[model samples]
Target: MTTSNWLLPEHLSDILPAEARRIEELRRAMLDLYRNCGFELVAPPLVEYTDSLFVGNSQDLKLQTNKLVDQLSGRTMGVRADMTSQVARIDAHLLNREGVARLCYCGSVLHARPSGLLADRELLQIGAEIYGYSGYEADLQIIQLALDSLALAGVQNTSLDLNHPGVSRALIEAAGLQEQAGEVLSLLKEKDVPGLRQLFEATTGVPDDIAAALIRLPSLYGDGNVLTEAASALPDLPGIRAALQALRTLVDALDATSVGIDLADVKGYDYHSGVSFAIFGRGWPDAIVRGGRYDNAGSSFGRARAATGFSLDLRKVSAGLAPAEPSRAVRAPWNSDPALGEKVRQLRQDGNVVVQFFPGTTQSIDEFVFDRELVSDNGQWVLKSTN
Candidate 1:
């Protein structure tokens, strides 16, 4: 006996109509936001050659993409786990002649389910990537644009925690524990401060200075005060100093009170050779949007292009919007004379959701029939209730 009538894979989720509408509205708003900023939107197929997945920034993403052999060629292809890599591939191969490309994408990206609803494998992702720019100004602009996109989605109180992957990479190499990079990063990603400390203790040939710096990375978050503290704390490490200066420069450029930089925060895509950032807001488990400079993501396509962009989880943004409903309080014409029936019928032709109640005939979303002058010409649009 088949006990299960049907089952959906654990990671998949459905977007209902109202929720889907909200998401679509957000997508339009965000795309328009980017389009206004000179970013041209492009989309890639859901599946592609396995190499396309690996030749980008995400090391873990390649393994997570859904894969199967193609029917005609008998070659393996994987569903993209992220859009950043795909867009980069397209830019390098298709738009290579162009000096730079500002690209955006909105669609579903598949990943192996991560044992949670929030990290569902089958998910809707709306994101963008800016490629072939050497300037960090491009990075700053994209991050700011991401914040704007979130604001456009009606997301409030978003915290933009900034970090430099190059800083962390330098710290790892400084500690002479480059092999421990993955373990240390895992700790940082989990916000496991104690775990990171233990990793530091486990590391051999570590300078006391670098060990201290590595241990402090996870807990560093706040306002401008956080950056000041980091400035004093990491005065000697070249990587940390460069990161601080970069952040200071970014801060000087930004004129908004809503944006803040967390100096001690370290997070990013692995190929973010320089700076990285994430955007957090209400209704999102972690950051609702994130992206960074993945210059090397284009190398797999045989071109070296610097890139930067950010994206919001469209489905999550959709989750926050209130649903809309059809109104049933439409007004219908009222009359005391029997000859007024024609007038009522004519009013119905205006498509005003008119309701005319006569024996065996009710015309409209709401009901409207008999009423005294006191209630009849109340000068309101809503129909009077007979009951």
Candidate 2:
């Protein structure tokens, strides 16, 4: 590659100072919010053994993970494309707590490929997980936390895309199309209605009623009324009915945030066995937050804990939101006076950013606005407003 092209790899770039500060501020605010919600923070490693990293119902992560050989061990290690599986390992093998464990994490994850057309190949993921709870209660808590997190980041006009894989899985199984279920699921997830109709027409032994419901899955997205419509349109199987009921309860509970149902919204259907949701905000073409219930995610690590959580890319979420005000700095002159040095120390102690000007070098205060400049007034240093 040429020198110019060597600056950054495709889909990856440096986060300059201004944006970096914004991201850091949001990260602190988000972690603090998680702490306030009784979620203890945990920092998992950036890379781990491929086997442990891709544990349990994580085929998607397996594909997205970038593998490398560890020099000392000569064993394959994978850069984590997601943190949930690692967190689950912590809960199952490391923590090993008896009752419910509420844990949260924030860190960067590397993906082998970009998630979307404009998505970043590297992302800073911030999320929380609840282990040992299987009911809608845990789902509701995580969903609410996701909304609150977005609000903290200054996101408005947000909508939640609620879904359940069980609803479609049940119908697919009932139709005896389990053999081609994977192909059908891919089509459903893409919302390729015309392609679905063609696929069903070509396939044999699918029941008429089941085929109709399968075709309807793509269109079953909208407001809360979509839930009622789904209940009426889809089969009365236990899984389908139970999924709809759970969604209805969630919708009712979410008073502040708007809710939409996508029966075929199977983004993580292979992984999440229960209620799954994606959060969207105004002007963002993709989900700002995505999370769901994955009860069997930790089975490979020794125990299967009912898990539900949400994760958002801090970079993407902060991109749509407003940047926070820059901290004001007090410009201090480089001097040998003890009292002047003490004044600078006191200003920094009081939570002000103090930028000192060197005696010999040329420095411009215009580079960044220094709200106040320290000047000697009759042998006593005092701050004079630049304004």
Candidate 3:
């Protein structure tokens, strides 16, 4: 029996010509946008040592990473599951700038498993990062950039969900529940009020007020009023107060129409240390972009700079948009004439797509529309509308 040689593994696929072209166009446009915004471009290696790849990353990132042994050194190497950590490594160790460093990157990332049931294991991740800035100013800039990115991709009616882990983290630490931080965070993320109550009920040494605040987190999600309610509902721990204030500052600063606050939505990498965010398009189920402050992300790379950035799967963004219109092109006859060659070259130089077909070549390509054709009129090559 023979299996199909062209078949790809599950959750992996080849991007065909049309989709590939659209994704590439979007990539170039986004990179230009980043550049105009003062972000210097950087490209990190596709694979690195597991130690470096997994540095300060969450267990989710480690599990998602595809690992292998480097035969040259007989050491473990892994394909990056997320480029954020690699970008952090570059800022901390490679650039080593004392002042703020704005960097952007675009590349392929591999995951051992799909992020969702309909998701692919491979992604074209593109994003921008700002290093050496820790203020709400940095967070606001990152957030605006993310919103601008979505707009550039023609994604509209998007809403922003804001969350700060410090709020929940503060309660957990103040209550001496750091040992159960994982379980507590999991429950809160799911908004499992019952589970949280049960955990606090059985766990000893947690103050009643802290447990109550922990249980209330699942309910502390809504419009701007959530912040006011949180200020009154939750205990006034320094971490909680600071986190709420940070969220308040951003909510005030952002001009976006649909902004939300979800105190329990700490569903990102564990490295996210401050105000974190997820931007969602109107109809899409998942966030179109995710980013936030991770001041400690670079500590493992040698320098602990303040870092904030956002990343989105370019392929996913392309998939959600309408099919790209076929590019208009001029059909040219196959010829060895120097004049014809020069004419074709000049047209292409002027940014026109000119397709030259062989003597018996069939017109079958779907990526370009042959709207016009090059023809000989009185010994001069000229463009004639096919229509």
Candidate 4:
């Protein structure tokens, strides 16, 4: 690349001042929200050993991770494409808390490629996690917390799509189609009815009931009523029945937010073993929040804990939201007087943004539109309104 083109790389750009301010404001608000909910903030390293980082059912994360050799140790180090795995490691090995542990994290994760045509290769991920809880209560709490976070960020007209991977997994296992499960799962994720039918038809010795169940999976999407339809349509396998009951319980408990169910929805099929959810705003094309229950993610760290959590891209959440109220600025004249310095310090200490004017400046200090100015009045320094 020529020097003239030495700007930002493809799918990557700097967040300028205005956007940066908005992102920071949202970040602080989200962290405060998590803190109030009893979640402790944790900052994991930007990179870690590839072996440890790729633990659990995270083949997608492994593909997205950017790998490089750590010269200091000669071992492959990977820039984290997701922070959930790191948090799991911390909970299982580092903190190793006995009871339920609530933790939150906010940081940048790098992806080797963009998620979509217009997606960024880097993202500011913020989320909260609950470990040591396996029941539907934990899932409901995390979902409610996610809704709260979106509300705090000013997201409106939101809808949540909920699913249980076990529903489809159970169907596949019961069908004796474990060998072709990967292909079947991919088709389900795409909602490709024709493709699924073709695959099933071409495959020999598929049980008639199982094939019919697989075909119905893609169409089993709608509001809470779909759960009833699913229960009646799917086979009488224990896992399938249990998953449907879980979804029904969640739907019955929810009141304020709009919810839907997609029995074939398996975005994180391999990673999330239980209920999975994605939040969609009115105008956003992609999900703003993606989370679910990944109970076995911490197994590699020597302890497997039941965990449920959600994460959102802070930058994306703040994109169309209103910026926070700007702080009042007090412009003070550049002077060597110790009293003047003390006054400036006092103003700042009282929660005001004070910008000192520099001597020999060509531009007017007032050009910055400071809300107030410190000037001599009646032979004493006083704050004069610039408005």
Best by lDDT: 3
Question: Candidate 4: lDDT over CA atoms?
Answer: 0.88
Q: How good is model 1 by TM-score? A: 0.80
| Candidate 2 TM-score over all chains jointly | 0.95
Q: Model 2: which residue pairs collide?
A: none
The candidate that wins on TM-score is 3
- Which pairs clash in the backbone of model 1? none
Error of 1 at 197 (Å): 3.5
Write the candidate numbers in order of decreasing lDDT: 3, 2, 4, 1
How does residue 377 of candidate 1 score in lDDT?
A: 51
Whole-model lDDT per candidate: 0.70, 0.89, 0.91, 0.88
Error of 4 at 26 (Å): 1.6
Estimate, for each residue in 38-66, the C-alpha lDDT of model 1 and write its tens digit: 88888899998887777744657765777
- What does candidate 4's lDDT look like per residue over 136-255, in tens digits? 999999999999999998899999999999998888887778888779998998999999889978988778888999999999998998988988898889999888888888888897
* lDDT (Cα) of model 3: 0.91
Which portions of model 3 miss their true places by more than 4 Å?
A: none
Estimate the Cα RMSD of every predicted model relative to the unseen true structure.
Answer: 6.2, 1.8, 1.5, 2.3
Between prediction 2 and prediction 3, the one with superior lDDT is: 3
- Residue 14 of model 1 has an lDDT of 73
Worst 10 residues of 4 by lDDT: 360-369
